[model samples]
Target: MDSLSYTPRGVLTPQRSLADLTWLRVGGPADWFFQPADEDDLAAFLKALPADVAVFPMGVGSNLIVRDGGIRAVVIRLGRGFNGIEVDGETVTAGAAALDAHVARKAAQAGRDLTFLRTIPGSIGGAVKMNAGCYGSYVADHLISVRIVTRAGEVQTLPAEALNLAYRSSQLPEGAVIVSATFRAAEGEPGALEARMVDQIAKRDASQPTKERSAGSTFRNPSGASSTGRADDTHELKAWAVIDKAGMRGATLGGAQMSEKHSNFLINAGGASAHDLEQLGEEVRKKVLQTQGISLEWEIMRIGEY
Candidate 1:
C-alpha cells in the first residue's frame, strides 16, 4: 500500500523509477511521482499536499545528476497537457514541459529567431532553471516573464527581474515549480535560421561528443568576474583542455570513463554507479587543480543523495 494526499487525474504514486525520465538514463526511485492532467489539476494537487512533504519539480532531466540513493520527496513532472507552444505576434508562450529544440524549430518555422535552442535537448523549465545557452545567444536574453507554482501551492507570474536570472542560475524557490514562460523572439528568415541550426549541429559534432552516452559539458566556464580569473585568451581554456593537461582525458573509474572524443564529457560505459561518476569527476578536478592551479566548476546539477 502507499500514502499520498494529492492524486492527479492521470496518476499518483510513490517509489517511481526515475531512470526513464533523464537524458543520462540514471537515478533511483522518487518517493512520490505526480503527473496531473493540466494546470488546474497541478495547482489543486499542490494545494492539497501536506506542508511537510517536500516537492521537487523536474523537466526532462537533461542536465541532472540524481544519485543512487534516490530522491525522498514528491516529484512533480509535467506532461501532455502542459506541453503546448503558442505564438502570438513575436512572442512565444510555451508550457514549461515543452522541449527547447521543438520550440526553437517552431519559432524558426514561424520566422522567429530562436536558433540557439535548436540543439539543446532539454525542456523550457530546465532551460530557465539552468539559464541554458548555446552559441552566443542565451535564454536570459529573450525571456519576458514566467509563471510559477509556489511550494505552498499558489500560482503567480514573476518578472525576469524577480527571478534574478543570471548565468546558469535563477533564484528558484526550494521546490517552486515553473509552469510556463513567454519569450520575445526576434524576426529572421526561416531558411537562414534553419541553415544556422544545421551548421551548429555540425560544429557541435566536430567539437563535442554529441552521440556518446555522457552528460554534456561537465563544468561551467569559470566566470570572468572570478576574483583571479585567467587572462583573456581568444578562446579560453575550457574544462577539456585543463583535464587533458592533467593527463585525465581518457581516465576511468569502475565503469565511468572520461570520453575520448571530448575530454570534458564523462561516460557510463555500462552499469556505472553514481558514486563512480562522481568520484571520477572529483579525481579529474583534483588533478587539474594540482597541475594547473585552476579550479573547475561543475555545470551538471548533482541532486538527491550518494
Candidate 2:
C-alpha cells in the first residue's frame, strides 16, 4: 500500500489489530488506524486524505463484529481529546468518545435524568448512531443536536431530526463522523437519579450476562404487526423469549455460545473467532425462522470482509 503525504498531531498506524478494541475480542487488523489529537486535527487529516480512501469512525466497540479478514478503510478512533463531558442547566454536552456510563453519572450528579445511558456499554457516538436506549427511554428522546465532520471534512452541527432516528437505528450521513452531542435531560433530584441508576445496574446484573465478554443484545426485538399477526397493535416481541421457545438458549458453536445466562447475548466463551460468533448468530436466526416463522434482524453492527 502507498503511504499518504498528509500528517497530523495524532497517532496513525498501519494495520492495527482490531481484536483488542472490541468486546468480542475477535477481528483482524484495520488498514490504517488514526487517533486525532482534537477536532481540528481530525478535520484537517480527513480533508487532506484522498477522497477515494474510505473512513470509518468507531466508538468503544461495544456492539460490533469486525470480520477476521479485517476492514480495508481508515479506522478513526477518538480518544482523550474527544472524551470531555460538560453539564449546563438541564443540558449535557458530551464528546463522542465519552463513555455512556460516564455521561450518565455526570448527568445524574447534576440533577439530570439520563439514567438510561448508564448500562449501555458504548460511547456517546455509538449511542447517537444507534439511538441507544434501555428502560423505556432512548437517546433520540433527549438529543438536541450533534456536531459531525462530513465526508468532505466540513464541520456541521445538525439537529436530531437530521439523523431520522428510529428504533435502534439512525440514518447518519455516509462517512460522516459524530464528534459531539448535546442532550436536553429532564430535571430531577440528584440523589434520586443516582439511586435510580444504581437500581437499574442491579437489575441488569441480575438478569443479563453482565460478567460475560459479549455485545449487549444480538437481535432487535421483532416489531410490526406482521410478526405477531396482530393488526391493531404493533408491540415488539422479545427476541430472547422467541429464541428460548425455539430451543436455542444454550446453543454453542466452537467457543461461541448463545449465552446460557441470557439467551439473547452472544458471548466469546473462550478463544472464539469472529467466524464462530457470526455463524452461531446465523444459526440462531435460521432456527428461529424455522420454528417461529419470524425473521430476526441483527441489532449488533457487523462490518468488514469475511
Candidate 3:
C-alpha cells in the first residue's frame, strides 16, 4: 500500500502471526499487520487500502476468543506511538490502544478516579467497544466522546450518547477504528486509590482464577423476570453460583474446562483448541438453561470462525 511508504517510521508486516496477540493466546496468522506511526499514518493507510479489503483494529485482546482458523483480514494494532495519555483537569484523553490499567494509573496519578479500569485486562478501545465495567461502574458512565476512523477511511468525533452505549456494548461501527477516547473521571486521592486497587486485585486473585489461561467472565447475568410474576434484577446473581448449582462446575471437554475454582471462568486446561473452549461453554450454557430458567449470554467476544 502507498501508506507504507507514506510514513517513514511506521511498522508494517505481511502475514504476521496472531496467536500471541490475544489473552486466549490462540489464532492463526493475519493477512497483514499494520501499526501506524501515528494518526496521520493510520489515516493514510486506511484511505489507501482497497475498498474490498477488510480492516480489523485490536487492542490488548482481553475479552476476545479468536478461533483457530484465524481472521482473514488486515489487522491493525496501535502501538505505544498511539498510546499516549493526556490528562486535563477532570478529563482524560487516551489513545485507543492504551492499557486500561495504564489509563487508570495515569488518571489516578493525576488525582482522578478512573480506578474502576485499574484491573480490566483489555485496552481502551476494547473497553469503549465492550462498555467494560467492574464494581457496578461501566465505561458508559465516564466516556465523553471518541474519535474514530470509519471503514470508508474518514475520521470523525462522536459523543458517547451517539454510540447508544448500554450494559456491555456500544454502537461503534463494525470496521471502524478508534483512534482516541476522552472520559470524565471523578477525583480521588492517589494513595487511597492505589491501596483500594491493590486490595481489589487481591480480591480478584482469590475469588477468580486470575492466573489461569482464561477470559475473565464467560457470561453476562440473566436479567429481568424470575417467572414468579415478580420484577427482578440479576445484578446480584453470580454466574459461577448458577453454573455450580447446575452441576456444571469443573466440567471438562478435551483441554478446556470450566474452572473448578470459579465456575464462571473457562480455562484452557492445556492444549485446548478454540473449538473445545467454545463447545464447553455451550455445554455449560445448556446445562444452566436446563437446570435453571435462566439463559446466559456470552460476555467474551467470539470472533473469526470455527
**Best-performing candidate as measured by lDDT:** 2
For model 1, name the residue pairs that clash.
none
lDDT of 2 at 253: 97
Arranged by lDDT with the best first, the candidates are: 2, 3, 1
Instruction: Estimate, for each residue in 136-159, the C-alpha lDDT of model 2 and write its tens digit.
Output: 778878999999998888999999
Candidate that would win on TM-score: 2
In terms of lDDT, which candidate is stronger, 2 or 3? Answer: 2
Which regions in candidate 1 have their CA more than 4 angstroms from the true location?
A: 1-6, 225-235
By TM-score, how accurate is candidate 1?
0.93
Score residue 241 of candidate 2 by CA lDDT. Answer: 87
Candidate 3 — which pairs collide?
Answer: none
Q: After superposition, how far is residue 182 of candidate 1 from its true place, in Å?
A: 0.6
Candidate 1 per-residue lDDT over residues 1-306, each given as its tens digit: 244476668678779988777766778888888887888888888888877888888888777777888898888999988789998889998899999988998999999988888888789998888777777677778889999888877899998778777666778877789999999999999999899998988988897777766778787665332211122122476668888889998899988889998888888777787788888999999998899898988888887877
RMSD from true fold, candidate 2? 2.9
